[model samples]
Target: MPLWLMILLGTIFGGLIFFAIFMFVRSRKKSKEALGASAGETSKYAGQAPPEPEVLAGQVAAIREHDAAFDEGRFLKWAEETFFKVQESWTERQASGARALMTDACFADHERRIGELLAKNEKNELDALAVSGTAIMGIESDKQTDTITVRFNAQCADYTVNAETGEVVRGNKAVGAWVEDWVFMRARPDYLAGGGEMPAGGLETNWRLARIDEVMG
Candidate 1:
């Protein structure tokens, strides 16, 4: 390879590696930083109220038309459970355990993250991880799918450890709280009823997380 070409290739490869590490660190324990909490702060949002569900009134009504069983209270309960379930899987690096609870794209992203951690011989530790509150912050629907954005108030002491040496490579072990938005989606019956293409499954498909987004304080 030409010298300049080699240098360019090396730079690109190095950038990708850095990006992967950056994303992994952000996902694992940067919630406080993302939420603008200082190092001495505990859980900044521990006493915070979840967004009012009233904002999603219209979206809930629309979703109920497709599946009358849709209930805000019930869904919030399930979402809170899901927050714990997914966090357990993430900390354990067992993407398979969360496959059914996430959309294909979401699953793929998590699976790849797990693979990368394994390759690097690192693990994210989430001790005392807990969700204090969960609520439907917003919802939207189309002929294809009904999507809900859930806001979660959670706290955890997250750190990355070396798998073999068991040394904490990053993050403080202090428990900190942060708020985040998790988006879940379910296929609409009409989309399947029409036999048209969709991002995921058809009739009787359960709600699955499509994505997770950081909520800035």
Candidate 2:
């Protein structure tokens, strides 16, 4: 071959080899970066430990120790009954019956709502109130108080009526199911007590409704 032709061939071959080497090095670097990212993600998740089951058990035991009458079944029963009574109080456009069953703040909220209804001459009526199921969602006790949150699924015939003429206004008479969470609170006792009887005459009770919130699915 002539000298110029040989020089051109050599240059082209060298260029091809260099390009190949560059591509191989770039690919290896990308692979290493991807693997490093994956490992970092794995370690991040693995560093978090799940809560121990015994921790929750210990919390419940502590709460039970504070109130000897702290039976889950009994508390749930009371919650169901109180739910109905609260609905009844709303229907009657009064809060007297539920006053003893609620905390001061909760009672104040109820009275405020009732006052608003009374000002508008309106009342809510709930008939055939039936609780389908109830579940204890959580229980906790602090230095001075114990709180239990319960979830209730119930059906009731709801309607808004005019207080003066007793006429249906807003809601229909059909029964509808609703989900609600009710929080109950009581003073944390230093010693265990035997009876679960609710205290009378005082605005505060051993178990009183703290708040109620609707749960949306």
Candidate 3:
């Protein structure tokens, strides 16, 4: 080959090598910059604090309503709907929806024991008295946990019986007291009354509604 041709070929080969090296260096710098940016982002997130969970405003309102209901002597209604509803569901064998209101040991064996007693006393008229007029002495609220403990001064009345067989059972007006604790959880009154297996989970409304009413008397 001629010297000119050799020189021209050599120049072309050198230019190709230089171009490859330049591209490789540029790519490596770009990769390193991207890695550094990613690291900075990750470190920032790791060092930063997380946001707190927000409590609903409606929960506060519900809490107030619960207190008002109790003060107004509507607890019997609440118990009939909430407590009795749970008991009813458990007896009906659809216990999934209603949270086990009573402890396992409290009424495990005597599921329908209360109901049986009440049924026997069906003929006797029962008058539910107000907490203020009867035995409810005082109530105190726990701010931290949002719980209320109502102290009672139990006042109960007895039924009357005929004197045909020397059975004169007069109404007994005795002040007896009982206390119950309530929490807000998914409660299905319909499910407890008749609806079968409650859905897997119940709603937690953050507040309980209380209702009171007289039955027999």
Candidate 4:
């Protein structure tokens, strides 16, 4: 080979070798950086261990059992606590008010309208029977970003009072049946019944939806 040709070939080969070494070193550096970053991530996660798989299963099972029991029980305890607790005093007050506010014929006519089919039993101590009923309630499950709708049945016991004497007549239990539908909207939170006003007293009373936003529904 000529002298110039030999020099040129030597330079080209040397350049190629240098380029290959540079590439190898660059790749190794990059791989080390990546591995270090990955190790950091792994260490961070390692500090917080995952929950046991059996724990999740147990929680799910408990929730299922609670739901089943609530369904079977018809949420009677919830109803009694919510309904009677709020209305017990009001109902008794209304019973006392009825004597001064209503006349015998008016009361009798009201009873006939209700299909109670009662005869004039006695005067001084006339017994009255309010009844138990099914109450419709809506419960909600809340999260940071959303809410879920939950529905359950509840039963409220009936309230009774003496018609003429305005005394609570608990000798015989009084019960009624009520079925209602409730709707839940995500945007409203301050719903009320009877337009947020106090409920009026009556026999076998029906609960009216005044402000639905207040309800959990």
Candidate No. with top lDDT = 1
The 0-to-1 C-alpha lDDT of every candidate, in the order given, reads 0.71, 0.63, 0.33, 0.30
What is the TM-score (0 to 1) of candidate 4? 0.21
| Rank list by TM-score | 1, 2, 3, 4
Scored by Cα lDDT, where does model 4 land?
0.30
Q: Which scores greater on lDDT, model 2 or model 3?
A: 2
The alpha-carbon root-mean-square deviation between model 3 and the true structure, to one decimal in Å, is 31.8
Off by over 4 Å in 2: 1-59, 191-205
Tens-digit lDDT string for candidate 2 (109-132): 677777767888977766687888
Clashes of 2: 0
lDDT of 4 by residue, 62-179 (tens): 4344233323134334433433322332333332322222223333332342232123221121123222343323233222111111122222333334567645433213232222
Candidate 3 per-residue lDDT over residues 1-217, each given as its tens digit: 9999999999999999999877654543332221100011111112223222232224334455534333324543453354445434433334333434432322332334334333544222223533332222122333222322222222233333332342424433332232222323333333334544543332222323121111111
Q: Lowest-scoring 10 consecutive residues by lDDT in candidate 1?
A: 34-43
Please, what's the RMSD in Å of model 1? 12.2
TM-score of 1: 0.73
lDDT (C-alpha) at residue 199 in model 3: 32
Clashing pairs in 3: 77-211, 77-212, 78-211, 135-153, 154-175, 154-176, 154-177, 155-175, 155-176, 158-172
